[model samples]
Target chain A: MTPSTDAPHSCTRSEDELWASLGSPPDAHELQCLTCQEQRRRLAPLAQAAQEWKTGTDPEESLLEGILGRVMHGIRTEIRRGTLFTLTVTPLGPLRISSYLLLEAIRDAVDSIEHVELRTHKIIPHADDAGPISLAVSLAMQAGQDGTEVAEETRRTIAARFAERIGMPIGTINVTVEDVFQ
Target chain B: MSGPEKPDQQQLGNLVARAQSGDPRAFEKILTYHQRGLLRFCTSMLVVPGDAEDVLQEVYLTAWRQLSTLHAPEALGTWLYRIARHRCIDHLRKRTPQPRDLQGPESLAGDIAASDDRSGENPESNAETNAAMTDLRRFVHELPANQRECWVLKEIHDLSYADISAIVSEPIATVRGRISRARTTLAERMRPWK
Candidate 1:
């Protein structure tokens, strides 16, 4: 007979030999030592019982959902606490814009990113002084009824534009996709 | 599973970036991705469903609040597990009705924590196994407290002996001994299923 898929935690051997030892094998000095045989004999039922206990308990669906909800809600609550925005000035800066306009655009862009809980994470410059700064953007997206990829692209696009309009050239535009999600 | 695996690194990385910068949605995605393993570890270690859930929430909240502290993005699984283990231990300590000790010395009292001495055998004696399971659960609970805990952490949870030793602040030998005896006594008590 083919061996059963499940194994006793103790046996650590083949079934054929396990019972074979029951008939003929080594003695206390040879193998299958008397105590080992007796121990195996004793442990047979408990191992079976453990397998049942392991399979018996099913994870709670509602409990898992509730835990996930609490975690996600906690993150959202942290996001809403305050707005932390990053500003990137490119080599191709318009150079003559009022500082007020620049700040306003950035603030507005920050709002746009956070509106959907996505935002400008890092500003990666291509060179020591690359023109149109390369923006390394991170978007924390919440997948809505809208498809996940669609939401991600939308967030990425919004972040890219915001980086461009912040009165600076954004080069090497790259999105460090963190989560595709939901 | 808490959330489906993203399967692609680019997507997960993007979400992580957004999360670090205050994008609540991105952080939430990460949370959903990792909740189950954390919960499972907690449930197994705590040995109580309710306490496990409570620790799960606390662990996640702490994970969020301290998210920025984690340096390795890919090591999130291991990091979260470590935190879960710590939190469960704390929760268990609070709920366990006993004095504080790292690992109580091994004694025969530890041997018979549950009872039974090798009568398990034959299909007809299966009832012995059933009773042992119930007894084993409580027996471990009645262990010298520390040895009981060390046994659970090392044997049942499949955590490393060293890890169990560190968690209980006991010597590795102590950890191994307790585990060996815990299994020994339990095995002798319920030997038919072997």
Candidate 2:
């Protein structure tokens, strides 16, 4: 018997429908139709190959280590060129710090708190030289922990750390519990 | 080869949020989790291992730089795949169009065979497996780029039609049509294997 082409021949169901039927159990019409059954049998190998390809382990898994190294190196270099923010005005020049540094400090402060994990934090510095900075932090609290208490504690910790690091008052610290983790 | 176990949705969300906040470790974690799948996708799209690696690197770097732009944390996997697809297209466009260079059936087949760990299997069985895989890859490579993209996204990557539509920036109907067309082509071409 000749192999079926992609076009529908005399059968009412198109070849595409036959191919799709291979994915599921045959319906009543499909069970009764010789054309559909033959087409499906021919299409079975391709379907099986696709399934194997999806579930099989990647051949290039070994290259991931090298790729990761290269990618992380690129990211770190970019991180080093961090955005510079003016911390305060000095006698001769403005005291500036990299946003990377500020973020790291905030991360450390958040990490020091128990039962609370920092998801994201944004520091909005005031436009003027010596105005209060606004801090927004999203956190994930440990399951069964008090979210309100954790948020309050996280806010106080970040506030104290920010005051010590920059000697500036914090304006409205927003601490939102974005997730709960075990 | 078996892929790594993916993190749960909540864990993935947490990682994305942390990465957005300039956490290098979190970003690296996210990248590592997705590396194998993305690399396979790039390899299929580019057909050149070196070029695939370059595009994969660009995908990660772009994702990291634009991490803030990704508002939906749960969509990171699809988002990364989209970046990869774009990068692969750009890379292919920049190449000096050589039809011969586009075909790399042996490359993927060799990689799979080399990495095959069925040590206890008989040599004849292994060879048959390799031959079948080579044929499969060749038939897939013979597909038109658009059909190949849709087919690979649907079959190999196991993406839904909607997700494939989002990645390819086409309508769901279009994506479905392309995949169906691809299936028909492959079904006809791979009849001997059946």
Question: For residues A23-57, what per-residue lDDT tens digits would candidate 2 score against the true structure?
Answer: 78999988888877877787776776776677766
RMSD per prediction, one decimal? 11.0, 5.5
When candidate 2 is compared with the true two-chain complex, its DockQ is 0.50
Each model's lDDT comes to: 0.54, 0.78
Q: Evaluate candidate 1 and give its CAPRI docking class based on DockQ.
A: incorrect
lDDT of 1 by residue, B82-116 (tens): 67767877887788544322224544455454243
True contacts kept of each: 0.42, 0.62
Q: For candidate 2, what is the DockQ-based docking class?
A: medium
Candidate 1: which stretches are off by over 4 Å? A1-31, A58-62, A84-120, A123-135, A138-182, B1-34, B47-49, B95-135, B144-178, B188-194
Off by over 4 Å in 2: A1-32, A86-95, A130-133, A142-144, A159-172, A178-182, B102-124
Listed in order, each prediction's TM-score against the native is: 0.53, 0.81
Candidate 1's displacement at residue B188, Å, is 4.1
